[model samples]
Target: MIPVELWPIASSLKGELLQMQRPQERFAFIIDCFKTYLSWE
Candidate 1:
């Protein structure tokens, strides 16, 4: 589960993902977001 502090970020990411028109684009975006989050840690 995501921490409370990160809920806002998670929510915004979810909103963006839902707005994406293609699965490929969503998949790529998710990967990029994951990479960025990993780098932050």
Candidate 2:
């Protein structure tokens, strides 16, 4: 399970990505987020 503190960051990341026009950047952002979460874990 994810930690509570990460929820806001995740939501904000999603929101930011949603407003973006570049699909590649959005995908990379998501991959980076996953990498970050893995590192945190």
| Candidate maximizing lDDT | 1
The Cα RMSD in angstroms, rounded to one decimal, for candidate 1 relative to the true structure is 0.7
Instruction: Give the top-scoring candidate (TM-score).
Output: 1
* Residue 7, candidate 1: alpha-carbon lDDT: 97
Error of 2 at 2 (Å): 4.6
Q: Looking at candidate 1, what is the lDDT of residue 10?
A: 96
Q: What lDDT tens digits, residue by residue, belong to model 1 across residues 1-41?
A: 89999999999999999999999999999999999989999
lDDT of 2 by residue, 1-41 (tens): 65798789778887999998899988888898789878976
Tell me how far the alpha carbon of residue 30 in candidate 2 is from the true structure, in angstroms, after superposition: 0.5
List candidate 1 segments past 4 Å from native: none
Task: For candidate 2, give the lDDT of residue 36.
Answer: 84
Alpha-carbon lDDT of model 2: 0.84
lDDT of 2 at 14: 76
Clashing pairs in 1: none
| Each prediction's whole-model lDDT (CA) | 0.96, 0.84
